[model samples]
Target: MTELLKPELYAVVGTMSAPLHPSLKGGRCMACGFVFFPPQRYGCEVCGRSGDCLQSIALSGSGTLIASATVHMHSPGARPTKHGVKPLEAPFTIGTIKLDDGPTIRTIIVDANEPSLKPGQRVISKLVEVGSGACSILDLRFAPAL
Candidate 1:
């Protein structure tokens, strides 16, 4: 009937009207020229101006390990559960990666069972899935070069 069609049309429109996820696109400062991943707030902290810049910037995943340490305790953002991801194993290595773009991000180091790791080691970025279904979230992880 007409009533039934109306509801269906609204549903379709609602889905299309949903705001895109921030992680789906890279972000650029609208004030200065600083580009950041996962987007950034307007009004550049560097130039202190707004609406001067506007554009989407992609992040370069290439980077190097600046420091690393092993973690034995589960933290709020570290653990993954049935609904999400849990710590794969105890004493996992977490490292600070310095991107070529001058941004430093902290991430878990995958397959760090080697004898040891050192600073200045080449590393690559990878996406980690946490949770399941609609609640899933993507996390950043790094791995040492072979």
Candidate 2:
């Protein structure tokens, strides 16, 4: 029998399921309605509410492409572990996407070439598998929305 693989990264992105489509998990201030990605752990930056006032909230992965650029160089050590992840190839396209809700985030653009991307293009979130063996990691990426 095949063993189930545990997620290398959890609580960051949703599973690849029907209703639980891939989305970023962020933090919301229960004291207020402010939301933040990389979920604030200390306290609400807006209202200064700490303790249990912070709650986990799922963020919409769909958004608009705001900007794009090709990275010609990067440090390997700065990259995620090379286990199941693909080797870093320069000139990859990463872009800023403005989530439909309110926040803007940067993500690697998949399923489209850098030259093809344009400002204001719609995109949807997708979870991709990287690395290999037991070190496999799941990463969030965006693609042109159909």
Candidate 3:
């Protein structure tokens, strides 16, 4: 079995065994009906209610891309590392997406058969392998739905 990079942020079910391919772990304010990502336990931003007022929910994986930018590096072998994370490779794209549910989030974009992204482009959540060893370490990513 593969390991999830962030089990608290999202969930992915096997294609043949489950219905939801991927879903974001989000939170909703039971009092005010406000929805937000990252499933925070703190007080809701829209209302002052906390504790029992916050409820965890599974959000749909579809969203619309608001904007995107690709980062490029100039020098080779000059990558910087923080903590234990290896420096990100150049030409990786980051996108600001507004989920269909209501909140906006920023995440890495991977080209999965879709063309260049533009504002208002449709995107969907997908799992990507990030580890290099025998055991697979899977992380979530946003990809164009075309």
Candidate 4:
């Protein structure tokens, strides 16, 4: 049987399922309508509200690429690693995506070469697997919208 890919960051990602769109999960402050990625649990940063006023919400997978950069050299050295989750390779593209809903998130640009992306371009979220062999981690990535 194939090993299941676990999320490296559970609070920031949703449960993975086939035929399901991959979206970055966020928290919305019910008190002030403030949306933030990587879901906050303590209190609202905008309105100083605490307790259960923060509700879990799913963000839109489609967004506009506001900023992007190509990494020529990378050293992911001395980073912590969880079981079954391996570090990704270097020289990848990373970009900031402004979701259609509200939040802006930084994500890996899948299959993108240097100088291939620009601001104001449309992109869509995708769930990808990082690492090799039997162990991998499920992660949210972005690609140009078709």
Each model's lDDT comes to 0.55, 0.71, 0.78, 0.72
Q: Which lDDT tens digits does candidate 4 get at residues 26-79?
A: 788999999888776888889989778999877767789999988777784734
Which segments of candidate 1 are over 4 A away from where they belong?
1-26, 30-32, 52-54, 75-84, 87-89, 128-138
Q: Which candidate number maximizes TM-score?
A: 3
lDDT of 3 by residue, 42-105 (tens): 7999987899999988877788999888777636765432222234677788889998887898
**Which digits, one per residue and each the tens of the lDDT, describe model 1 over residues 1-146?**
01111121111111122212111234566555665544554656566555537555444555688999887765557544344344466668888877655567776788675347789988765455543454545555667766
Ranking by lDDT: 3, 4, 2, 1
Looking at candidate 3, what is the lDDT of residue 133? 62
Q: Rank the candidates by TM-score, best first.
A: 3, 4, 2, 1
- Residue 40's lDDT within candidate 4 is 69
RMSD of each: 10.9, 3.9, 4.1, 3.7
**How many backbone clashes are present in model 4?**
0
Q: What is the clash tally of candidate 1?
A: 6
lDDT (C-alpha) at residue 71 in model 1: 74
Q: What is the number of backbone collisions in each predicted candidate, taken in the order shown?
A: 6, 5, 0, 0
Task: Tell me each candidate's TM-score.
Answer: 0.61, 0.77, 0.83, 0.80
